[model samples]
Target: MTEIKQPIEMDITEVVKATGLASSAIRYYEKKGLIHSIGRKGLKRVYHRDVLMRLALISLAQQAHFSLDEIAQLSVNQKVPEINRNMVHSKIEEIDTKISELIQLRD
Candidate 1:
């Protein structure tokens, strides 16, 4: 007898709640190739659990002003699968400069 693995499934609403992202944003990310759906049950979209982490990373990278293409490149060479340290450091510096400028304006 052969054992069959059941497909993991989650409702689109649950996915959005778990990820703290809007449903439309999820669809946009899927369309942008930043995320994807495993399959659909009726009209509800299902996704693999790993997608949660991927979406979180995408959100953080976007806040850091990293473009989708840059974020994709950062994911390359993924034996360990981490954001590129160099890119992250550069983004931090950019953010710091922006913050400093804002502080000066406020002063």
Candidate 2:
């Protein structure tokens, strides 16, 4: 008979390593409702593996100038689309303007 291997479960420390975010930031995101955690085991926080992907998306959205509240709105549902396209477009325009100003200043 062949032996089968079980998948390893990740803990909060592993999640921080995979997402490249500080532990505080993860806690803040959870508080802001941008991400959720699985019920804790003892004093340690536990999370599903999918949280890595959620944190990645959150970081990318923040880099694009979205506020925590706005990001929370976008992250509300994975099954249903929650992002407001117009809001995202406006934010993109704002970021583009800032980039243009920086380029002009450097010239």
Highest lDDT model number: 1
What's the TM-score of each model vs. the native?
A: 0.71, 0.78
Q: Write the per-residue lDDT of candidate 2 for residues 15-105, one digit (tens) a residue.
A: 8888788999988888887777777878778887777767878888888878888887775426344778888888889989999999999
Candidate models: Cα lDDT each: 0.79, 0.78
Clashes found in each candidate (C-alpha, N, C closer than 3 A): 0, 0
Encode model 1's per-residue lDDT on 1-107: one tens digit a residue. 99997446777888888888999988887787777788898998988867777887887888879888887777822334566799888888999999999999999
Of the candidates shown, which would achieve the greatest TM-score relative to the real structure? 2
Give me the overall lDDT of model 2.
0.78
Off by over 4 Å in 2: 1-9, 76-81
Q: What TM-score would you give candidate 2 relative to the actual structure?
A: 0.78
